[model samples]
Target: MSSPEQWTRPEPGAGPAATAAQPSPEQVIAGLRATAEGGAELTQLLTPEGERQPSRFDPYLADIDDAALRGLYRDMVLVRRADRECNAMQRQGQLGIWVPLLGQEAAQVGSGRALKPQDMAFPSYREHGVAYTRGVDFRELLGIFRCTDHSAWDFREHGFHPYTIVIGNQVLNATGYAMGQKFEGKVGNTDPDGKPSGTDEATIVYFGDGATSQGDVHEGFVWAAVYDAPVVFFCQNNQWAISEPTERQSRLPLYQRARGYGFPGIRVDGNDVLACLAVTRWALDECRHGNGPVLIEAFTYRMDAHTTTDDPTRYRLSDEIEVWKHKDPIERVRVHLARTGGADQEFFDQVQADADAFAAELRDYCFNMPDPPPERIFSEVYAEPSAALDAQREEYLAYLSGFADGGEQ
Candidate 1:
């Protein structure tokens, strides 16, 4: 395994002058190498045509009948509609801003569904869909973007952490949490009956392509490898990080980076829901067995703007978006369902209706979401209010009351 000490050393033949402080560029290059020495498996359970491949993690997905597959399809559709609708809401001035997961529904849903009740998740801001799957209120996510609240749900309550706005900060946090779980003896031990103990829980953290450039992410890799953290560092390599393409992030494939960290790293077709689910489940299982942390780079295309505020048309071509549209995640699942006779016309119709109804309800909720009480703003800022804050709050309230004509009375 490549340690931090190894990464900091100067290469041979770089001369004595090339000390740790001032190593030659060639020495630095030789010292820091790519991690893809050993490749990984990228399985696709349900092909675009909706066929099944044997899954080693069959226990995780064994009960997924035709109706269940249709439910998964419904999940993708509703989430996408919710995503696109939120973007449109932002455009129409309902939300302050929006992050569109337009083309990555399968990536989010597949992995999100793989999570058990005990498993924890750490997410970037774009993981609203995954949050939705975890029983987080859809409107709660809007509170952050709408500038109504800092975070919507309590982390402990949801078994999910607050959305980290900093690119890769959650990567390390997830690793640390998993490590803590291990230290607490919550992982790797068998049950009294000699059966596998379900008490041990794994963690999954989501990140984007740009996060690969952050030092925190690399440090996360280091810590996870050393301690064998039960964490899955899921990198949704959506091809572009803002205006910068994947080419600028690293020379080799992103999934291969896991080798240097002494763990398995697999690359899946992010646009393929089955592929994403199969790969993520396998990685999580390895973690549950105390054999991880794993890295997953879901290779996908970002078919929408980086955010509602961004204009992808400024930097990317129309043809590129069109190309990915043909590889639409929802379409492939529908194809698979149709091909395998898993879903008939009635099923498709019900799914469409469900998606539309959910979208409409979400739109209503977003518009009707009450603005939080003024005091709620500072409620969680401090567990116990300091003297200064108390005095300030009183003064502010008094000042506001003067303008309000004592409306409370």
Candidate 2:
């Protein structure tokens, strides 16, 4: 046995007493809410007021001219319109459910545009803007929401994997795929002139801050770190994971977690399209050079409910939503374009018209989409024919046939 003073552990820090130094619950909540402005670590090239900010990452955006910037703005507008249309359709019972990417257009489109043709992307469902950049037809996505198809686009053709509904599982898939790329010598290849040989490839996996707590995500991080896989872990930290706040998930910022896994971590203002493009370009370049894996925490906010089924008002304050509205991703780009004369009123009108047409096309496609045959589910279960599955399919069809004219027996 030791004396009380000898056995006592020292206070953790040099501040006041431990309890006195700690922040109250209200303070913590306030801090979490104030994070909408991001921190000093955040890499931003565009301000909420639509002013351009100089950054060390500017070199990565040397290729983005006025035309390209206008294109990015157009992409965000169309994506946002499509998202709103889908959400409305879901409410009207056209889609089974809709996952709206209302405030995340910049994060998805900027990073999506940064990808080369050979790169692969694994998305965690709400990456509609990315799908657009990957050459996936907007009409094809309607099939998934309408429940007429699992995924209509070919992954090999688009370099975009089918959406993963299971939280954080796509990270493991992307990691394994990246490891395969390394084993095949697809990364870090160079020509005799010390230039890229054009065979370099990388994989990017998208996840949410909430998924960081999942065991699968942790395991994926560890495996990627140990193997040095050319995978970029893109965490869209949209503040809330459903009803749970980011503060509840991790004490440290999400990007800081990469240091523990032995990789570089970057935090970018996800609402700034220019910054997202620049940071993603740098991260992809690192992966192509085999200096991966990197973690990017995109500081964004989700301005809509998690899905058509969620009611955000029950969990979050309207004041917080109003605060984020001032930082709307699409408006910033539009303002920048107008202020700088990068785009005129004609350009804005045309983009809005195009977005309206796009939404109309999506609505038409969803309304006219045909339902899949009941046996369609059994068809894709296996590569080779299975007798047991065939028998089960026949049994299911026969059972369905027992009803008269598709009505109850």
Candidate 3:
């Protein structure tokens, strides 16, 4: 990126003469190739074709045994299935709205598995995949979209906050939590010498490329850096912030922005599950040892619309989606598991069967879910019901009863 003073635009009246001679076809193709190469500079442990690639970060992948690798595959498969079901339900009118994590399964599952139980997670609304890896039932996710609960599960019990619909706000929450951990000596207690220690808990917060432009996220970065908070800012740069492409948000790669905050930033191939796992594990380890507040930009693409209500075709090209298909995260893992003898045909079949059964059960649950009583909403808002709230609920119920059954008010 260049400062405005260092770069200049042509005079507005120059018209066609201002065109800096359109690039030759060969030059255009070369520039595209270069762009891809720059992106490929990130740490990638696995290729889209299911081949294992070596990197300096290889040590982080040590404990990821064949069984663990298979488990990761299972996580992505099931998460993807659940997401697809949610999208379908929304389209079928069983859900009011749905945020599908269509193509980012590997990124979510890989990083979600890296956290220890004591650590915390503050998620953006679409982290259903992370919730899955955290052991939250897929069925639980539907309730929120079904408009019955604020969220599907309890935030405190799971060490995961309720989904923050306000973009980038969760970053501050995660940062504050990490700061609290430091204030209470939760961090660096086990590693007095500052060496790596797994005993110290960390916080991992998820956001998207768009959030990078938000003040809350930047504020979180500043707070985390200054306080040395044991927080990892995981940004899934899925190439778009709704209809706005990433270029509009940042002049440079999102990861590089961490430099301004005085911490290390890393870019990992988000579509590569093994790579995401390794990078996230390293980030959490750094925080545990009190060298925290890392920013990891997971470079990937969202293969679906921003939400069920979004018409992606209006904003993006079909060719772009097709290109990302070759880089499907789940497909690579499945291919690796089979080709490398990590998993057999029987195992693959079992995984598919389980995923299908789970999706079917979820569909049944969504279809049969009864409308929540109107009074139920006010009950959960406060721990001890107040007279005003109770009276308000009663008044609302009375108004609702004014309408005849199946008749307009």
Candidate 4:
């Protein structure tokens, strides 16, 4: 059993010069001399250096041609650009707050792309990459954090749920949805031909390393396992749940927890987009075959603060941040694309230009989007109307009306 400390302990040699006074994230990571020593069943199709290896998942990539590969790259690039702009907006006081998914792009994008349009996804707040794959407009995402709307778009329209800010609770909701689909015979198709045979659906829920400790997450696991729900529990274990490390969260690797829940769990190199897509595809296939609910622990890292409000330097060492940068999800794919001739200078240039234009558009949208009307605060308090809320809304409105028209009325 690999301990939590083993899972998170900094790579060897923190470098002699590393000190509390002058911190260097780069030097701390470059000094490490460790290699891939041992692990439980972890799948890796793309190496950090952008090399491909033979794996059981090779067949899954048959349809992922060079053009498709370029598309995925484009997804990562644009999503990252949007995320960066949102973070900047928050810093500029345009947004209330922002959840930055700096290093977890591949894990979100790969799995999101694997999902069918009919399938549903439940997300924690930081799923910008998934939103991009779902064809969600960037402005819609801004509406949420800016407090202008409940959601950017209809959830069912994109099959992507509104972001759940309350941590792991969405796991149970996703499981219940999956179970309902199961009872309705909506499990994925088992046909030899890969077309949809029925309109039934599968569900996927995204949470983080911290949420695994929540009772709701565990209960969702239990119910899904017992009922054979066609759901994929995707946990991007990015090594920290706020300031607490995985070592403090569990005794062993998080994926191992699925074994106790009586289903198979697989760990994948979350930084490798190909591996993430392959593993998620395999799990979703199992769900369609009624052999579900599969748990996928995307072994990855969060290369930034948990949110814009967080000061990562206070909790984690600079060296620790540097170490994970080597395994960056976007860079690996870019390297592969360049080396394999999957994309050329023109393609790369176009992507950068597109990202810039997209970011500019997002900046304008966020700045121009109006604040929710005051009436919005009072609406939707209850199914009918609540006396207390109604009275409060009326009083607030009266106060506003008095100030209007130079206090004439």
Candidate 5:
């Protein structure tokens, strides 16, 4: 990991030794453009054209053989299919709203698959791919968009927290959880080589570029940094916070913000699943062995609108979208698998069939979902029964009963 001091230095030409301490107008304009290339600092194991590249982080991916690589490709395909189905369902009024993870499949799946069973994840609302990697049922997530339940799965069992809708709030929750893990001595056990040798755990919090501007995220950084909490701040820089471009959020790259908080930060090619997996594994290992609270900025794009209700076309150009389409995460992986003979046409066809079935199942579940009764909300509000709450529930139920047949009054 590079030291914080290294990140603070001005780029060779931008420092006081050059023209000025601040960037030139042209440099600022360049910064505002969507950086799909991720500049020179980007850690990439596979190019957008599906060519493999070597990196220092390659050792972290030793366990990912050709079979595992094919599995990763399948995961992305299924996730993208499910995402599209949910988006269409929302349009058809089957869901209240849907958050699309269309272009971020590699970022979520790679990082998510890096986590151990004991690790915890706190996610922002658009983490359907992460949820899938964590063994969460696709139908359970549908309940959230259907407005039928908060989250149907056991978060503790899954090592995944309920999807947080408010931006950056999950950072605080994840920091606190990591602090607890440290307090319980779940971190810092390692061998002489600094590799984990005991029962060590870590936490990862997922947020977006827009959330970087939030006070909660900054506070989480400060607290996690000061305590050396075992948390990885995973920011998927999808280039837009709704219609607002990432340039409007910060002049510097998002990953560089970690230097000020006293930890190492890295930028990875988010569209390259191989790079994401390697980099995330390295970060998590650092955290487990006590060198903690790393920041990872995944340089990716949002190929679709932010949410079902959002309109990306209003703020971004068609040309920009066209450019990112060439870097489609799933297509690159598919190309790599085919090129390497890791998978064949039969395998690709099978994966497509499976994804189609997955999407169809989700659509069936959403359409047939039973609406909860008004009194159902009161059932889960308290672990211990409360007289006041019971009275309120009783009165509410009675009020509903007074209607012609339930709700026709």
Candidate 6:
């Protein structure tokens, strides 16, 4: 069993003021309300101008050198570029559909990078950024959109579960995995220096604003709390789930709802990459130490339609989109880099060339990829193919191969 130090929170109904001068839960809640109303930014590290904030979160930012920060910026830009290409490919009838993460790159990348190799991630479809961070081939992501494969990569190899399309459905799966990590005795173990080791595996699950209304998400919360599972419920509150605005989802702010489930939750400026990184690091560390599950409502916006099938113009105003343009995560980082970190024309040119080359390679791979044999479809449908399934497979293969030229002219 984990020691008492594994968890850290005020005793039941005990407020922070009793031990420290810190604000109580009610005061924290009220402060958050005031902050939201004033449209103030919720962040712990990194300023809009690319400066680091002075706080505990600063330690996380300390090791990130200028080159590393540039790399982070590059990752966000490359992911967005891939997103754009995929969207265009779908429009051109190359893909069945594409989920664009135009405005949520920072939220995904920052949180995604915070994960350790031992950690597991369960993500909703929009977490293409997370997939990239886990070393899943960027072009492999297109396989699902192209209808060529059920999932592009093996989950176990990448520490990523298959992308879940049904909103909030993967939350329970994540909680279960975290519970498994506990049962495997991965928690409460430390190295020689009395520090936690890789044996402490945590899980981070991603969902959207609309998923909060789903029964699966609520059940996930309940299970994680009951088992003390090492999981973080990462909600990217992008303000819209299809045509529905966030206002229609719930009355109270999303983060505070965690209290009802007996967990800790916080809201961060999702557009601010540094803040997302800091908050996610905190959340993951807490989970690894057994102080979980944590709920993070990343306050962000969806800059594009829900998917290729929907059009935003039908329900939203152009001015609203324009307003979010200032909060553009990529542009903000670039501005900070250029103004403070001396990101000059040469750096910009090199990054752009690299991005372009990457996109070209992805296009080539996607277009030239060979389709799986028709018979292979039913191969994994069952542990062992039943007589009826075998007969059906034979029939289909025969019918498919019966075409005058072996199904090919």
Cα misplacement distance, residue 238 of candidate 3 (Å) = 0.5
> lDDT tens digits, residues 1-409, model 1?
3322233342364353223344444433332222211124555566545556676656667667878778778989989888888988898888999988988888898889888788999999898778987888887888888888877687787887888888899998998999997788766778889876887789999999889999999999999999999999999888778986554456467888988878988888787777777678778878887886999888777778898889888865565666677778899889888888888989889888888888888889988988776666556778876888888778877766787665242
Please provide, for model 5 over 160-196, each residue's C-alpha lDDT reduced to its tens digit, 9 standing for 90 to 100: 9999998999999999999999888988887788766
Q: List the residue pairs that clash in candidate 3.
A: none
- lDDT against the true structure, each candidate: 0.78, 0.88, 0.83, 0.83, 0.88, 0.81
The local lDDT score (0 to 100) that residue 363 gets in candidate 1 is: 88
Please, what are the lDDT tens digits per residue for candidate 3 over residues 111-213? Answer: 9998888888999999998888777777877888988877768777787888899999999999999999988888776556756565678999999998888
Relative to the true structure, candidate 1 reaches a TM of 0.86
lDDT of 3: 0.83
- TM-score per candidate: 0.86, 0.93, 0.89, 0.87, 0.91, 0.87
For candidate 3, the per-residue lDDT at 254 reads: 84
Candidate achieving the largest TM-score = 2
The parts of candidate 1 lying over 4 Å away from their true place are: 1-42, 49-60, 398-409
Give the Cα error of residue 263 in candidate 4, in Å.
Answer: 0.6
**In model 5, which regions exceed 4 Å deviation?**
1-34, 190-195
Clashing pairs in 1: 49-336, 50-336
- Residues 11-129 of candidate 4: C-alpha lDDT, one tens digit per residue: 46542233222324443233222112115477888888999888998888899999988998898898899899999999999998999999899999999998888889999999989
| Greater-TM-score candidate between 1 and 5 | 5
Global lDDT of model 5: 0.88
**How many steric overlaps does candidate 1 have?**
2
Candidate 3 structure, TM-score to reference: 0.89
